[model samples]
Target: MIKNRDIVCIANTTWFGEYTKSTVQLMSRLAKNNRVLFVEYPFTWKDTLTTFLGKQKAPVSRMLGLKSRLELINTENGSKVYNLVPPPVLPVDFIKKDQLFKPFFNLNVALYKIALRKVMKKMEVKDPIVITAYNPFYGLPLIGQLNEALNVYYCYDGIGTRRHGKRIYAIDEAFSKNVDAIVTTSDYINDDKKKFNPKSYVVKNGVDFDTFYADAKNKVHKNEQKIVGYIGSLDHRFDINTVEFAVKNMPDTLYHFTGNLRNQEIKQRLDKFDNVEFFGSVKPNDVPALLATYDVGIIPYLVNDINKNIYPLKINEYMAVGVPVVMTPFADLKDFSGMVSVAENNETFVKTLITELEKDSRSAINKRIEFAKSNSWDIKAEEFGEILNKLLENGND
Candidate 1:
């Protein structure tokens, strides 16, 4: 019901044809009623220069394709995606010296401020609700300059736990305290944010049920061969040892991983298993068809502080296609006990996969589909809208 308002979302992800994450999903849905400007993370001169010189032809092409330093692309929904080119800034991760870093960081902020002013003027954006995800360094500087009606810090990950996160934790903490509202994807993140902002709320991730559920009835793989699939980024969070054990234990089952492999060492480690197949990144539209071919979906995440807080969207995506999920122990998995088979370790995870594959029935599929329908992106967007409405109604008092 929050309609006709201008909403400016500063996100870590790019809007130019990539895997849709929570920010993109929410903004897309919100666009049905509101005017949205999705500002992608600014590209530094180094990034542009590197992309120009890099062997990756696609990125170089995309960079060259930019019509303007700030190009606006109109979406099917009532939203505009603005891609910004940032001035050269010190790479915060590599630069350890404060004396050298602060000057460049300040210059980066000043340059962005000018760029943002131009974007606002071009779009005729005024008194907009500013929603920022991940990059607090960018958001912190723009806090008072924009004349934003409300400032929302959307925390999707335990960013402070990561290697490069230590440098920005203090900035994030300050941003959280100053923001009008803090929205988090998990309870752990929400609890942490509440220490700084009492207005923090947990709005967990959801799936795009329409696209996913449409293919739920399509049982393309009628073969007797069982396919155990894992989708999403194959990064450090992925439990390679658990997957190795599971694949080794179940020689008959075909293990398929569909995603961009961030950790080459892990992929190399798992390559020895002939049963394990790696299908490098598939388009988001092609996911449900891939899910339809899956006998069971596995979330073999390494249990750690970072992984524990993650409410995996793949779990919902798998369930949306009526595929039973076998996941490693995570705090948020407790809510999904009925739909997902939670496993403590490699032994239980493998056992659960076998059990789910053996007992895959119409009744179970229906149950999962029904549960997924209730947690669609539409529903989550409505819940998020309600919170935003309350904030606007109260004038962020």
Candidate 2:
């Protein structure tokens, strides 16, 4: 373990719903030895009040939907420390959400600096370890400005996710240069970071083996009508067309989706298909249970500039639950050629589904389970501790 137990982790996220299992798992692991203080972004309580009121008046309270709740990154060892950051005293909503918000948000950055200074003083943190999960706008600049004893930037997703244009890119570049060391969830980012920071490490995301492992005794039987499922964000990165094709060709198969609908128009378009079932959003704890209920899992991703490189954590989750997965051949899945069924287009996906359905081989399912067992959160946590310990000794020399 790292010598320093008093560490402060600053994240832009306030809501646990916004975070992935890997993100939460990291905090859980760190808290064992570290006095980790998690700082969250400000949320509007008024939103919750408005949502409750709106639900009684209007049919749908879309405008006043309940705000996501902030979580105090919980620990395993029972010793804990955390705080939810209060919203900016300044009226943040007065500014319009547009290109101008970039500069306006910079003001929030200033407020954050003040807030951080005050918080550090209040907590009596002299020289603590500072770790950042997001970059450019939030974590990067905040950690960079703090000048902590040890600074780590964890790049989990692609850099393209934070873009609004050239301005965002500039901010990202400035923030990238300031960090002492970099850790990525994928090897691709580690390879790319070699040009910028030589001290880069790959800490691939893993699953909660206990929670997601196939309950062989309790494994629900696959329905006579095949259930093809996709869980996660229904964002631009997902291939809606591929899913549509799958639904059309395999009319017998029930297309089940469980996640927040990012695009209402896309959702409305999907309404025509009776086979497609959108179960909206479910809690993280409910995901394994949901996956268990499904016959098969799929990552119908739109392979492009954004998704081609980044490794998604969902693949491992699907595998852990022993649900056969079909994915677009992304770089991450390409390595697991035999472990998963790769489909180039809708036609291939449909054909492969039928073939897999007909075959229903136990060997393929076992391979996936074996692969998933090798990559658990416990393993990733150990790897993370090792890296943190090294960083402490090396002192970012």
Top of the candidates by TM-score:
1
Task: List clashing residue pairs in candidate 2.
Answer: none
lDDT of 2 by residue, 160-179 (tens): 63334545555556666777
Cα TM-score per model: 0.93, 0.85
Model 1, CA-based lDDT: 0.80
Q: Write the per-residue lDDT of candidate 1 for residues 138-228, one digit (tens) a residue.
A: 8988897788998999889887545344668788889999999999998888888899999998788999998899889534346678899
After superposition on all C-alphas, the RMSD of every candidate to the true structure, in Å, is 2.3, 4.8
Candidate 2 runs further than 4 Å off: 18-21, 43-81, 89-103, 161-164, 214-222
Give Cα distance to truth, residue 360, candidate 1, Å.
Answer: 0.8
Model 2 steric clash total: 0
Which ten residues in a row are the worst by lDDT in model 2? Answer: 56-65
